[model samples]
Target: MEKNNRVIHHPILGDLKFRSLINFKFNEKVYSGFEGETIAAALLASGVRTLRCQEETGTPRGIYCNIGHCYECRVQVDGVLGVRACLTPIKEGMAVRSGEKLPAPFKKEGDA
Candidate 1:
């Protein structure tokens, strides 16, 4: 069995195909996703619903509008913060972290 089977196949539009799979990390856990797909789409396809939590209320949040309108899917990508998963495209070796607050900056090799 292959991944990305969750992509809907339209009768008129034909089969929806994704690009080559790329490796990404979420909270240090590795996951595979296709190129050009939004981070939220990849996460949902992988069964990850909880994208992050409210900063003040600490309530769980996930993909709501799936567009840039909703900020529910905010996640930390690489060392940056407040990146919208629904609008951000997945890239190879991207590190994504979801939490109530922004994650600490990632340290590179030989960093003090």
Candidate 2:
């Protein structure tokens, strides 16, 4: 974690060691994360909460279901939309950004 101490050393999980360090961008800001970790995990470890926006109201949203079952962690990757952060692995020099104009869950699917 960047000077903020976002990543914690877990007693059970042990020290989260990484094989290599990867540099990525979030909202155009440079960030560092460990390779082989999920984008959502990396971001969370670095203290990023909001991952996307609710298109209807423009409200900020973030990770909900860590697994792929829910798409709540949707983010834009390299200018592509609808990339799920929780499922997407972080790569060196990857560009990630909160989903701009991403519609609210129900609204996007026309749910009642």
Candidate 3:
């Protein structure tokens, strides 16, 4: 089925039609979501919001902006962490997870 970026006619959210349902694995748990839907949205629909947090504060974070500006919706997809879940699309067999810490900013040796 063709993918669309509308969430008004979703099957689960009756009358809200969303993109075609697709299967994906979140932290090894099988889940189904729509094709153009954000990873965070799918997780939230499935009752999952805690994706990851800042290493220093340990504060709970999820899709705060839903726009990709805030990094609160970061999650690991297929072993890659620090990815904005609100910006990534759901795909069949995609692997997603939480509790990932972003890598430290790279610094040039002896450049300090």
Candidate 4:
């Protein structure tokens, strides 16, 4: 089964049916989304609203402000830490992960 997370028509951008569909992995699960869209946008479209949980209280958090101001949409990409999901454009085969539960952050895997 194929799931489409993109809008079929846009008033400004015209038809979105021809946009490039790319596959990306989020916390080990593969999802298809349009290339060049923000990671937060793609995730939201795929019904994933919780980007990460609060480190202190474990409260769920997703995109807020939808810009670069607030840090609520932070996510790890390609082993890099704290990349803003709303500002960063997702690419094909990209590996994205939520912040608090990630091993690289908790274990400091590369630190000696």
Candidate 5:
């Protein structure tokens, strides 16, 4: 079998392995994943392509940039929307859903 160029093998990082398996919900479906891995990475490993929707068009989007700059990989984690999945670490029992907008911050009348 041939290897894909986009695939990566870390020599020093070597055979990435994790023992602890945790359960989390993604888009209302229960998924088992390991701790210490980014939510995006875990989802990608699990064949989850689309993460959230675009703001304007409401079209589905996924991890265009694995790094945290693009914001395409946003997901709702534990009721918080627009949380960057690429930056967030996967936790056990996390309720993750996909959407576009972030939960609006509460603003006091006199504060602003």
Candidate 6:
């Protein structure tokens, strides 16, 4: 409760009622966020900045280019990998976790 990262009082989007607060699991921990918000938004509100790590280096990566262009906020949802948290809506009881960096879906010609 001490560390609230949510911008509850913004000049433009002022005073959201937050009537439909929903609960979901992130990294085996329970977190509550407003319904209808994207998973990325919810996680941000919950003070979770590091969504995932670099594929090879394992450096922390959070929400960048929140419009879904960067793909830096990709996370696993309900056991599915490579889900764009910025685009995916947070569902009640959904299990969200930091995704493991996997190889690209398609391999290059020389790749085995």
Local accuracy of candidate 5 as per-residue lDDT tens digits, 6-112: 22457787665565877788988877667777888778877888887766567789998889998878888998777899999899989999875444346557865
The local distance difference test score of each candidate is: 0.83, 0.83, 0.77, 0.83, 0.77, 0.84
Tens-digit lDDT track for model 6 on 1-112?
6245777687998885675978899899988878789999888877888998887667888899999898988898999888999999988999999976655556668977
Score every model by TM-score.
0.81, 0.81, 0.73, 0.79, 0.74, 0.84
Q: Itemize residue pairs with steric clashes in candidate 1.
A: none
lDDT of 4 at 45: 85
Question: Which candidate order results from sorting by TM-score in descending order?
Answer: 6, 2, 1, 4, 5, 3
lDDT of 3 by residue, 26-76 (tens): 878887788797788788887776888676567777778998897888888
Q: Would you give me the overall lDDT of model 3? A: 0.77
How far is 99's C-alpha from truth in model 5 (Å)? Answer: 1.0
Candidate 5 wrong stretches, greater than 4 Å = 1-14, 100-112
Best by TM-score: 6
Clashes of 3: 7
Candidate 5, position 12, lDDT: 85
In candidate 1, residue 2 scores what lDDT?
27
Count of backbone clashes, every candidate in sequence:
0, 0, 7, 0, 0, 0
Better by TM-score, candidate 4 or 3: 4
> Model 4, which residues run further than 4 Å from truth?
1-5, 11-14, 101-112
Off by over 4 Å in 3: 1-14, 103-112
**Candidate 3, clashing residue pairs?**
8-16, 8-17, 9-15, 9-16, 9-17, 10-16, 10-17
lDDT of 4 by residue, 1-112 (tens): 5445668789999886556888898888987778678899888888888998876567888999998998888899999988999999889999999887433335355857
The residue pairs in collision within model 5 are none
